[model samples]
Target: MGNRLDRDQVVGTALELLNDVGLEGLTLRRIGKELDVQAPALYWHFKNKQDLLDAMATEMLRRMNALQEREQEAEGGSGTGTWQETLAGSHRTLRRVLLAYRDGAKVYSGTRFTDTSYAIPMERFLAPLVRDGFTPGEAARAFYTVYCFTIGYVIEEQSAADDPGRGVKGIDVAERAERLAEFPLAAAAGAELFGDADAGFEAGVAAIVAGIAATRERGRKVN
Candidate 1:
């Protein structure tokens, strides 16, 4: 018989297993085995795998949102130097964290939690946008767009964890170029556009924020 596994211990062990084997490889039985306990023991803490995943996601976001909130507080909730800088910082942090572990983005995007842990980051990240005259709804939408793009980009960027040479494999640069030659604009910019993840994220966030600012300015004129 093994000693009792506390809530934190359970979550920590589960997270360890998740990182080692990914979301698809994680299971209650495996976690219990790792802790030298029966599967039923885990059930006592988490109702099911979904419950465990929700808790894990909450835990991960809690740490991220905390740092963001502190930065927000330091910057006065609304007056950060550059909203786009803040967005880039937050999303870059998120991207790095998700890419550090296996299937991290999938786990994060798949779960739903009501805990304000998730919203605190958004509130902080959106502060600059709101201060810049974007309506609350616009800020929210813009935030969502940046977040979705970051997650999607990371997932696609790291999906080939099982392959070491994934990047070079099947990459027929010449063929791809020839195929896209019909579209002059895409062909010209395709390589440059997809080359840098960080650059793409910054550009995307900048464009979104610019659009929001424009919308706000337009609305102000109308009003």
Candidate 2:
């Protein structure tokens, strides 16, 4: 009898290949080859490339879900900190997880299955706004801003890793400093903006949370 491959085994292999070859290079044929099985065998578990990608995406979200659940539990089953604190912690945890593999955010964002990862956080994040007197629609919009900032930030950060020299190749800093001297503020802050993603991520999350609160207050006044 042939060795029956389980779903976990298959998805695990796919993840392994994803780390090794990235999304573009991942294919059923390649996964099968890695598994020492026929390509057709993979079809028994997944319908197509998208199906496989969705499974992988779900697996990643599963990890995030577990982490957040434990985090919430540690807070005595409620998000005791400020909403910014809760959300920033989640973002930091996510960045660490995604950074563990090659093309992690690409695998995450490129796949269509974000509901598993998003739904819980969405609920947790929006609840504060709703409790604070914002309408559901307003809260939803705020959540989108935070979501967009985090996702966009990670994608740009990871893409930089692929190109080496931190994506500023062949540019002599001394020469660039002379050119940027006309813009003193830019020269002073450019390094801060680019240095240390952990700090940047926290700062961006803080700004977004503040923006959300301010927008909610404005909406309350208009109402």
Per-candidate local distance difference test: 0.73, 0.72
Candidate that scores best on lDDT:
1
For model 2, the superposed segments whose C-alpha errors exceed 4 Å read 1-5, 75-77, 114-118, 162-189
Candidate 1, residues 1-223, lDDT tens digits: the string is: 2344487788778777876888888999999899999899787778899998888878778767666667668868653657777766888778877766778788788788737767667776788877876678877787777889888877766676675243322233456678998888877665545445567666777776677667767888999
Q: Which stretches of candidate 1 lie over 4 Å from their true place?
A: 1-5, 66-79, 164-194, 221-223
Q: Write the per-residue lDDT of candidate 2 for residues 1-223, one digit (tens) a residue.
A: 1344576688888888876787788999999999899999888888898888888877887788788788678768676566566556767777777766666777777677734566776687677767766688876776666766776777767665555355222233455567799998877665556665667778888888887767667877998
lDDT of 2 at 206: 86
Tell me each candidate's TM-score: 0.77, 0.79
The collision pairs in model 1 are none
The per-candidate count of clashes, in order, stands at 0, 0
